[model samples]
Target chain A: MSMVEKKLSTKTQVILTLLFILGMALLLWWADKGFDSYKQRVLRLIGIYAIMAVSLNLINGITGIFSLGHAGFILIGAYTAAILTLTPSEKAMSYLFGIQPWIKNLHADFFTATLAGGFMAALAAFLIGWPVLRLTGDYLAIASLGFAEIVRIWANNALTITNGPLGLKAIPEYSNIWWVYGWLLFTVVFIASLVYSSYGRALKAIRESRIAAESMGINVFKHQLMSFVVGAFFAGISGSLYAHWLTTVDPRITTMGPMLTFYVLIMIVLGGLGSITGSLIGAAIFAILFEWLRDLEQPFNFFGITVPGIPGIRILVISALFIAVMIFWQRGIMGREELTWNNLYKWLFARRKEGEKS
Target chain B: MNQEVFFLQNFFNALMLGGLYALIAVGYTMVYGILRLINFAHGDIMMMGVYFAFYTAVLFSSPPLIAAIVAVAGAAGLGFLIDRIAYKPLRNAPRISALITAIGMSFFLESFAVVVFGAVQKPFVQIFKTKESKVILNKVLMVGGARIPLLTFLVILLTLAIFAVLFLIVYKSKIGMAMRAISMDIPTTALMGINVDGVIGFTFALGSALAAASGIMWAMRYPNVYPYMGFMPGMKAFIAAVVGGIGSIPGAVVGGLLLGFIEIFTVSYFPTMSGYRDAFSFIILILILMFKPSGILGKKAIEKV
Candidate 1:
């Protein structure tokens, strides 16, 4: 309450903020300059996927709903963005079931296209989630999965825009590590802010006990829809980034079935639910581990001991690790706790006794 | 335009397909009736059965009957193990946890199969070589001159026999009574000194055996057996279970037959819309879940306020 105390608090907050910003800035600089092209691309991929995994946490973690259909939203965003950003010349040269003559001449840049795609995905979620979110538990999970499959099937059949099974090719590669990291920061900050707000509390309450929350006069269905839509919006954005980054989009990319959804859910579950920091850490760890394991197929001779087809071995090991982690270390790394400055500060200073508890 | 003949063929095909679907669906419905969990790995278990049968056939160069016996045994073992490992530990856990574990088990088994089977597509050759025979029903007034296949009739007969056996087991035996009691109230059944785990395991084994039988029949009809083939059919059968009133044995059979007819007829009549087959089933599932979660034959279960 004293003036000096208030000043000290303000200065501490500013210093913490500056330190966090400087660390992220350093990471971005390193990615942009110091890393090789492949490493840079991997970092970019991680940034985008981290946004996706964390955004998905809003629904699966905060909302406590099992949705196996995040990929469908991503597909919607990717296609929408791809169509919006396709060059006029490209549209003219090749027609997908014949694009409208008027729209053929228009093209939006990557930024606008990504936003537009994400918006469309949000709209789709709003429409679908209203009716579909009523179901509880596994029924909801399968229904959402069914919805994703429906989207994929429709996309495959809708030749006019989707180009059928052939998929959209030659998409512009406008996504870079800087852009990806910028979006990643945007997603993390946005989600963290939302989770700290009253709405986030209501959502978390709904997740913990839907019936009890409903009894307490929380509009459970509305919150579920809101969380689902928000989560879906970022998934769509990530999808847009994926489309632009890969420069190609196919229906099969989404069809890997429950595997993709399973991995995302595993990531969130392995990272404690209802924890934003957990989502970030889990995503980073999983993406890096998965990529590193994928590279194991290449023979890496360690002291003349030749190892071959290491990727296959990596999968077996990772799966065993997953089983072990799920069985023993459930609640993942964070256990629903945020890795915030206060915790670090507390840990760093040790116990200052009752007088310095604050 | 031989409408009658085309209709007959479609009807027969649908009925046969539905019978097989019903065979698989009963297991899903039974498990769900007691456990209230969707056993996502059920489909993969069916695939495992087919693979087992395929391996058995290759091993002994035996007839179809012997191969089927081996497949059923393999499926039963897996079903028992799945219950013991995944479902047993999570009996008191949240429903979603079990479902997630089921998904994990599904992934584990499928991936294991992929690694074991080398992820290659395998064709299932019917060991029972049934030659197609043309049957003239009222030959004078040939309805589009369509001849019903002998195998279709055999499928219908086999379906009836199996269901009769199932009905007898479910209705006439002590286990059936216990299964019914458990479905109604687990706590009460446990108080009555019933071995819930054993009953559940048996139910899983029985269901799995049925699924394996259906898988073999399905492979014979389709002639293509791949590791991933069970996913779509399993989904379809699950939908059928939902539509038919998931806990009712008769309901599952009815649902399966109806779904099969709908799919076959729709695909045949509207070839262009054939690609939407899976979508159509999913939409049906969503509609059922939204409007009639209890299903056609299912009793409405309520939670205490």
Candidate 2:
């Protein structure tokens, strides 16, 4: 609490943050140039998942908005990016059912497509947020879920724009470690900064008590809508990364449904809903566990006997863990506490004082 | 077939489908009415019911009647256990926590089905029907030039019979009264010496049984069973419950039938739009939520804050 300690903490925080960024740069370089194809892919997926969990945290965790329509927005982003970035010939191959001439001829670079995707999803959130945000609690959740389902069903039926369930194939693989991690870092800083600013405090107040926030002159709807749009923008960016990483855009239920939203939900809940670093940690753990669980579906050796693979046993285990966490450890890893330099400094100072006493 | 007959046939199909949905919707409306939990696993529980029946008849070579009885009882028990295990611990927790748990329970049942029952589709015929003997269920009825199956009428009549019994139990039974009290005010109901948990468990059991009955009938109409079979119907039924106005029993049935009519009529009128059948229901759901958030029959709920 002393002034000198505060000054030291501020300086240390800046230096540590710079070092951390540098460390990440080094790690990214190693992963991109040194790691194998599979490792790179996993790394990319981890980055994308972090983006989703952190952004989702802003709305569901920070702002207390239970929106399940992120998957729908992701679908929008993915389809938009896929359409914009696909070459005319690639579009021709996928649209065996026929396509609108403008979309067929449409083409853009990966960055432009991703930006367009994010903007499109943001636009959608703005349009729907007015009506959907008015419903509180479970009504909001269900109505948003309905929106996602409607998007999914329409995507499957809209032959001209979405390629009608055949989905776009031959998407460019542009989501390398650089792009994925770059966007993830930006997302973390953007959301964390917003969470700590005056706006962030206002958002938290709205979450605690909307009426109180309104009484304090905080525009509850505007803030909720902002968080929703921003969260959706990040989700859209992640969707673009996901599409480019997978090199396809099938908008199937498994890929873009309540299940996908649930996966992100689980990540945020596990990471401690309100913590940015918590979500990042949660995403990392989840990404690794999900990939590892795939082995459960492949034949494995036991102590004495070879056990046959169980296809869905992995999801069963994860889902079980989700319930257990909800029942036993609901605060998650962070519990609204962030891992920061000030806390670090205080811990070190207390340690020195204890050493002197000992 | 003539145009009139085709229309008649589709109408009958809609009626049967609507009846089946009504059966499922009752389960959802009852549970949501009381616990304020969406019971996301309701559909999966119905799916489990079909599997329970499928196994009972297939593995044990039991009669269809026995399979049906076992399925209803099994689903009731599962529903009860789901409450005891998952929802009970979180009764006093935040509503959001309960909601997350509900979604998790849904995934648990689904993956459990996939791992245990296997993902492949299985034939869902009634037990002991020999190939040569035409079962009464398989027999078709011709009325006004429309060839309708006897099962169609059976499904509709069976739904009505169940609804009448459900009405009696809900409006007349002690447990039903307890359920009604709990829904109105859980804390007050508890204060008044009603065993709120027991009522909730009973509500879940009753709802699960209804879902099972509908699942069994749904299987007969569709004639194939898979682990994921209940999901679509389960979702549609909830929407049906909402359309009729959630938390209202009569509203659920009316909503189910209305939704069924919309789905069938939409498909019949525009065959090209058949793939978008699911979308129409959701479109209707969104519009309903926007215009009349309480649903057609639901009372207007005043926001507390």
Clashing pairs in model 1, backbone N/Cα/C closer than 3 A: none
* Reference-based lDDT, residue B215, model 1: 90
Scored by TM-score, the top model is: 2
lDDT of each: 0.81, 0.89
Candidate 2 scores a chain A TM-score of 0.95
- Give the clashing pairs for model 2: none
lDDT of 2 by residue, B1-305 (tens): 78999999999999988988889999999988987778889999999999999999889987788999999999999999999999999999998899899999999999999999998888887454665333556789998999999989988999999999999999999888888888899999999998888889989999999999999988888888887787788888999998899999999999999999999999998999899888888778778888888988998888576
- Interface root mean square deviation of every model, in Å? 2.3, 1.0
For model 2, report DockQ.
0.74
Those runs of model 1 whose alpha carbons end farther than 4 Å from true positions after fitting are A1-14, A92-103, A253-256, A296-320, A347-358, B126-144
Candidate 1 local lDDT, B219-273, one digit each (tens): 8667777667788888889999989998888889988988898889999999999
- Please provide, for model 1 over A203-318, each residue's C-alpha lDDT reduced to its tens digit, 9 standing for 90 to 100: 88988888899999999998888889988899889889988888888887324245567667777777776788898888788778878877666777768888665424455455
